[model samples]
Target: MAEAGWYPDPAGGEGYRYWDGDRWSAQTQLRPGGTSAAPGAGHDPSTPIVVKGSSDDDEDEPRAGLWSQVKGPVVIIAIVLVTIIALIWALMQLGVLGNRGPGPSNPTEFCPAVTDGNYSVDPHPRDGRVYGGELSYPQLGAPWSAPTVDGRVPFGRDVQTQTITIEQNYRPGQNWVASVLVGELIDGDGFQSPEAGMDMVARCIVGAFYGDSPVQREDVTRRPMVVDGREAFMLEMHLSFDVRGLQAKGETAIIIIVNTSGSKNSIYYASIPDNAQQYLPTARDLVNQLRVGG
Candidate 1:
């Protein structure tokens, strides 16, 4: 079929070609525009061909097409996208969604003056300390002395506020850790700052002290606590002593962490080697005796 005049389309446009009808011979030949060409003008019969514009030799330019009409819309859409991105960037620069928003609520949210509760509010005798709600939450324990965190509590009432401090007079023998957590718990969404809050400080302390260090199974310790009249938790670790960047030969000492987000939860751990193993249960018993709701 290919050898014959009209050739079969290998690329699948139109179908087979052939001798137009005899005498003239050869399949069919299209001129520059699909018009049949004269018998034989030396044009190759087998070459794949296409027809150009069928209009006359001289034609004026056509008007703009639909694509041209769409350019304005495309440009507008691009501009809108850029504007949105710029707005977001500006907001970020203004410290809107970043680490620099409003600080946490005052540490003394529900203080004694606000409500007639047995709780007493006291500053930690440090500058920047804000409201302090010191009452033995009747739930955990009562007549408790809750002071503002070690220092740097909320001094200003509005906008930015925070309390950050670290206090450690941990009593391992009694399974008691005298900690001064500085932070706040916001009443609303997670917008509240973490200073004056225990979780961040405790985690920081734990990560700093015991992180990546070795802990023997037998040396592991966990204890219970009542924090600000809430159920609490604790942990203590015997770390090999090291100082001045020198490996001081002794067991590493560390306080793991204590968590008590529950009611009547008991913790375990001790500082004194003898009581260390006996720490948690005893402290838990005492915590149980604590009157938290006052």
Candidate 2:
């Protein structure tokens, strides 16, 4: 029999287990590199001595260390953390999370404060000459009367169908009208180019004129062009709407924004209702004849 001390685990796990004279103890420790006989080999014991089997080459072989045991779990944890961080960054970019700053200011908000000396309130001429500031266009005869300040917004003067009347609660498309606005672009307009500014202004007009009404716009197109040798942009669209107490179902709208002298811009807006579709050709002719200067 062999007297026992610490020996290779009888269970074949990678360590040493404590052994008493009668049986193996529960205590354990790291295995030293080789397999050896039990301590005090010639003593008497109740149980047969057990020896672990190993080759001569295994004497110098390294055991699996702590890093090897935890490597897989560490790599898995790192991958999960990276995925979570990437997801958060994507959400922030899409404005689903994190702070998103305010959008562009509506250009029409600056119109009321514009006080240019070149602007005047005058009745437009009937003999093909209609003037608003430095801008002018030919008049559409009969039902399309002279331009007036009665239904004018701070942004411009307008000409309307003769059948329509201006009232205290007048909406823009309520009576189909063509407006010509000429003024200097103010500081807070929130746009640096005529194209971008005109697009914003067109959206504002839709909101103001057809408040709370379901409006569908179709055949919308825009292009850059030269008007009286000045840079200009034109946006045209067909608006169909269903509003309470309004007889017209839809209208064709055209908006032209021209960058004139210095910081000034000229705008021409026209809307012809579906009920009076016959006048659309006349409106087009008027736009074709626009003149920017003397």
Question: Which candidate leads in lDDT?
Answer: 2
The digit string of per-residue lDDT tens for model 2 on 173-269 reads: 5444433333233323634566868755676666656656766665467798888888888888888876665667778888777776666676666
lDDT of each: 0.32, 0.58
Model 2 ranges with Cα > 4 A deviation? 1-128, 150-154, 157-188
Provide the lDDT at 293 for model 2: 57
| Per-residue lDDT of model 1, residues 76-173, tens digit only | 99999999999988776543445422121112332212122212233433332222221121111222234332222222111111111112223223
Estimate the TM-score of every prediction: 0.25, 0.51
Worst 10 residues of 2 by lDDT: 99-108
Give candidate 2's total backbone clashes: 0
